[model samples]
Target: MAGRVVPAISLKDYESRREEITKQLVEAAETAGFLTLIDHGITIEEIEAQFALSKAYFDLPKEIKDKVPHNLTTNNGYEYYVRKHFPFLAVLLCPIKGPSTGSIDQKESFWLQRNSEWPSDEDVPTFRAKTLNFIGKCEDISNKVLTCLSIALGFEEDYFCKAMDTHQPDNLSQMRLLHYPASEGAQGTWRAGVHTDIGCLTLLFQRDGEDGLEICPGRESHSSFAVGDTFFPLPAETGPIVVNIGDMLMAWSDDRLKANFHRVRAKESGHSPDRYSIAYFNTGRKDVIMQGPLKKYPAITCNEYFLHHTKIQFGHNAKKKQEAAAAEKPSVVAATA
Candidate 1:
């Protein structure tokens, strides 16, 4: 069914049958890049409250919001009143095109990272308190989601978490808030373009009733998405979050877990105000180069692929070549001298 909408999982069932829930999550992720999580223990009131706060922050005057510009320390954090031009995170989450066409996504998003500095009582005041509370709660939710992922992947619940901690203080996890304004005339421009997430995994909390996210089947032979050539529109559920595998997770899984391509169209509903969603992304440590298992699939370096992707963006083909030469020069000199 190209246009078919699937039913979502029930929270009550999820809570009651923990083992079964874990299996379903594992199978869904292994075959399909995405799954709708129910009984995730997050409440409707909490989702609404987070959305309300996001709206309040976004609704502020553009000038007022622009004070906190995107910073590298924050890594594109706090983008206000604009859609995201850096669609790699979005593209990397899902790769819609077989060969990437380089058409960037057209949605605006705000990025937030964990605060490294101890806040001065007066510097942020109440805002700091609210943000910390919100992020702390969401981080817990994200960790639980990761735990589920561990169970599904046939690994210890702490496997990914502990491996990720190898590069402490600068973990790859991130929180992104999106606002999709109604696009009445824009026929082709999607809220997001077809791409894969660059990191390991992603958990999304979206508005309860609105539906826009669509997923394509996996490209691998065992992929669930391989059943069809068409896209599957995600069914809306009240207060449940959508979980999806990303490139990094796929890398970790030795290509067993697919990071399929997906896209979001501009909201068609005239009645609904702008759509708001908060997504958390997890990443592996920078120092640890990702290497897939050779027993299962061909061995490939995660860091090499990632560096290649980033280098594509920066026009650093020459620099990369030079670095490669430099790396080999020492070995050559050692052999001779």
Candidate 2:
């Protein structure tokens, strides 16, 4: 595969270079559907501190982490591998295996939304305060990107910003902290499965040297599976945030933008190191209706769109779980006999 062609655009003098930045961002969205942002105002120190906090949270006992288990209604709090598919069941019971590898993503995540009730600071000192501060920085960058995209798509500069207003009670935007545990070259396993972000935009921060992120360029379908696509590596590098277009944004643009498939796979050779990354998902508020000027698709509320996408992503998994359960029933009956 060719080395990275994903554009790394600078946000330096953003006010002065709005037109140039907008052009570059729109171009990347149309082609690669992924790009990196440098000089975007968040310091390396701040990023590191947030990573530290993430580690501290993940280091806690499973029971402690489970205290804030992810809520399906709100899409916030802690979640283990494929837990979102069967919120009340264990991974063994609901194995949402990936199509290519037939293995579950070996990762856990903590999601935070604007109105999420954070984990107690007593568990991880200043976790709430520090995380909220970092989230604000991420939101600022996300809004700026949204502004650029708005202008590129011929909408008012604040159109997306207003639709995704952070202060709104129904806003669904989220900051996710992800941890992929170290593995001893587990065959068929992946840190994450191939999928596209479900929201409008995503800003991702990865720790240097923990590379596994890859993307399949030129994907035309909105489906998470890459049918005939080739994947290319996107190494983890500190400082710059990797940004990508998401399903909602593509729908909002009437397919002008792309939401490409991406994944984090296990290394083929040696042991795979533990991986850590943070992502800010910019989703429109629940009540906000999304439809581009071209109206190529049906107009839908953000909440309904999210539900439709979630069903597409995990509906098969639920069916598979039932089939697996049925297949195991005979064995259990014989063993009991």
Candidate 3:
């Protein structure tokens, strides 16, 4: 299935429709694994303002932006497009016959980590405070979502909330802003490659009119071939913030809930305007381990699991290439001989 749209799952008056909304949430998580959220508490104006602020940062000159190079390890600061970071694009989009020429597609992004080190600049003096303010709202929504999931699983309302309390150290979730430049005729390129998120859940906002996000159901859909017919545009962002279960949630649910594969296009055929999105990746402390309420899964700390596994999902091909190159290199013994 492409994606489901569940209307007005109220964040207010929870006592009124707790079971009703819980059923919708669980059904979407199990089936489509992706859903458009409405009545999520964050207002359209706030959403617009956040996007505008992100746009301002993104519009700054390249030299100015480069002041903060990305921290690949933590995914903090700015990142210039590198094909390997999005492995599925290399495998799928690059081969589609466009400007890519089998190389990485270009996109730029900024990641904001809660209470982590941040860059200060005169250009966007208010950037830090405003962004943080928006993220605070995002965290509240995510917490309520955790509660809903607990209800869906037939557990006490606070079961998941207590398990993933953000106040605890190492559990800080993050928000990321993405900018996809308008692409003309391209050989083959992609905005984001096919991959599943490693966090507990992801809340995505597509700038009002832009379209490029695509998703495929189930974990297996991330592989090369399955991406063709199965992939479809996520419902447009109008009044709906698309939400999906991520890998952590999948493991915690013993795979009862899914973390579906999703992607963004490198170019939208002939689109002229840039595409922007804000994504909140919901997760617990890094130290938190992957485990289910039923104890049906083995435990691995969130950081350890995502580092070894998430990178593989994003750049499995790149890793394979490195391995191949290493194996093919002539040994010192052979060279000396």
Candidate 4:
């Protein structure tokens, strides 16, 4: 028989029978570090509408889209028609930069954060209204899922929610709209190079496609499946948003749970069509210390790992940028010559 399908949980079901469901969720997390969630209570119609809006926005002329070019100033908001490798390599908490370290993702991305307060009527008009509604729905799902996480980890219902509350200003949620050009004769590993997410959690809504996603489960030993060294393709399912724990969650769990490493390989040479996916990233509060829950698992802090990795990876990138800048300087070139 084929492998067991990944378990999908509903928030309502979880709440009514928190004890049993929490056990299952925690067990699944410990083993897989990822799970597909169904009946998250978000409707497919809403998801489809959001996708339509994203497509409309992306379809705008590149010149018009450039008005909101991605920049550090607005926390990299509204990336449009941009092609570049992942930024903040060090901050991403990966050993090797990533599968797409040097090469760029074959798609454009747009970023957005949680609005501090509801936007006024005039700023975006219809756009603002739809965005706020979408975000509200997403936030509800996030809160409910997080509550399950608390229960799964044997913490009081409000533990993580309260800690996260203080960092509401830095919710840093992102709505990334990706458009992968038609792969007629593409020569590469995949549309999005192999990489794991950096945030605590990722919620994905992918457009129509038979298959593209792949996962390489973390291995307990050096010798294991070939996917242990590379990404293994995962088939797309009809419902239940694909949810994966990222480096942040692994760190928060104090090694109890792992961050799933996954990647996408381009579709069959002749059959691959353009692909699109919108990912809703739930970035933790900037200053919220992600320590292991009290009286849960071994005592450790996500902050410790974050600082450790950040210092190493981030410092390296900063140095590289500095070196590149120096090399580009006219005076430096003249002196060298």
Candidate 5:
């Protein structure tokens, strides 16, 4: 089966259906690595507003958008990574390349992290405030799902919740706004490259028929890319948000749940020119340490594992130690407001 849609889940009435919900969640995570969430309490109207905000922000003049450059030290703000300007080191592992490996993923993004600087409401009137509420709702829903996942793994309901420390001051959870422009008939190009998320869980919102997302299910190892791996097209229903397991959760489950590899517009599937989506990554508090329930993996701070994993998977040039420290420390400086 392609990506399946789990029934609507309610945090308020959680216990009544805990067992059933846990079973479904576990099965999907172990086999499909992707699931759609329905009746998640956050309405489609609310999500559409967030999507509109993403569009408004990206539509800004180049000067206004570039003012907020996303970099290693400041993990938030706008990132304009023209596929042509990519560094050689970063492209070594990029599977599909043109005349040069650097020119592969053509995309633009805006990242918002917990307690990080945000564009003022004046810039995108009421966006900063509304989006914060959207983030809160997503975090709440993610915690509820984590609760069920813990039960599925035979741990206390709050085991994963406590490890996430969602309310902590230095939480690394983020809600990212992404826009993938049309390929313009550009061959051998993608909106985003093949990569796995670096978190415990990711809640993704995409408008139906505005599709480009693809997944290689059950393919976890970064070094190996197989042609026969299951490449599934996402179910792009208008009402539901997609959810997937990430590296941290995969490690926490001792590889029972795989960190699925995915890419956006990686093929000539005739995707729409304008694609917009929101991804809320539950990276957990940088200080919260994690290990598999069976001690199958060594304990490491969330921050440490994230940076280390990104370095190996994406070949990021940042020093691991410095990146880990940057994740925890309060802003001495920020890329933008």
Candidate 6:
């Protein structure tokens, strides 16, 4: 069977045409698990400006970037690919690793929350103010999307928004600035591994001519890590933002929605250009419990479910490394003897 085509929905006149938009969004979420959104209130110029700022931040020296290392507890700050390994406890929460490759993702990222401390003006002058402003814009879009999803699920329009309230101290919604450096000759490495996002919804912005995003939508309903043999390319372009459902929403909708497997594969020629993209992950407050009205799945708190889902998604990589270390220990003893 042919793969589903990702639908594009317009957010123009959203206030007046909300019911129509909600149906389209829910249909896309149910079938393709992804969609392209246009006229979503954010301008192309604003997106490019944020992309430029992201490049400047990633271009800084490693030492400077390291100043604001990632905090496992808060899930904020810079994370370089080379130093991607997490503390034993943190490994349970880090879900970027690829199950097939048994290696870390090739890209680096800077995670930002509303309350996160900004980089100093000396390092990047406009970074703080511009980024926060952009985040607010993205949040506006997110809230609108969430409102639609809530109405589709037979709840009040503000139901999901209240659960993901940014003002809450434990809100987990965040924006990420990602940089996938050019891989001119690297082989057997993925820019990003195959996995489903753990949040409720994700808004992704990508540049033109830098295509690598692929999705296996046929496996959308699969509960495990298995994927279909055929994959479909979801090219990156300007103007429209790519939006997708995530595990949290899938569960919240009692499988009525999908959170399909996706990844960034290397080009056929083994060469890839530098790729920069921005992602806004909208998650519920840590204390909020998520479960569908139908009660198909057990209710679980946001943070607890995140950890549980990541463990199922990336736990094998940790176990694989441990086994390899254990196997090498006997050889080292023999060499010493």
Which one wins on lDDT?
Answer: 2
Query: Poorest 10 consecutive residues of model 1 by lDDT?
Result: 328-337
Write one digit per residue (lDDT tens) for candidate 4, span 303-334. Answer: 33344443333343444434543354232111
What TM-score, computed on C-alpha atoms, does each candidate reach? 0.73, 0.87, 0.81, 0.75, 0.85, 0.86
Q: For residue 71, what is the lDDT in candidate 1?
A: 51
Which should have the higher TM-score, number 1 or number 5?
5
Descending-lDDT candidate ranking: 2, 6, 5, 3, 1, 4
Candidate 1: residue 92 lDDT (0-100)? 41
Cα lDDT, model 2, residue 169: 66
- Relative to the true structure, candidate 2 reaches a TM of 0.87
Candidate 2 weakest lDDT stretch, 10 residues: 328-337
Task: List candidate 2 stretches off by more than 4 Å.
Answer: 1-4, 83-102, 221-227, 316-337
TM-score of 1: 0.73
Q: Residue-wise lDDT of candidate 6 within 36-116, one digit each (tens)?
A: 999998888998898989999999998899888876556678988733323342233223332344457788999989899
Give the count of colliding residue pairs in each prediction. Answer: 18, 0, 14, 3, 0, 0
After the best TM-score superposition of candidate 1, give how far the Cα of residue 117 lies from its true spot, in angstroms. 8.8
Instruction: Give the best candidate by TM-score.
Output: 2
Q: After superposition, how far is residue 279 of candidate 6 from its true place, in Å?
A: 0.4
Report every candidate's CA lDDT.
0.58, 0.81, 0.68, 0.57, 0.70, 0.78
lDDT of 1 at 66: 59
C-alpha lDDT of residue 193 in model 5: 63
Candidate 1 shows a clash count of 18
Q: What's the C-alpha lDDT at position 91 in model 5? A: 46
Candidate 6's C-alpha runs over 4 A off are: 1-4, 82-99, 220-222, 316-337
Least accurate stretch of 10 residues (summed lDDT) in model 6?
328-337
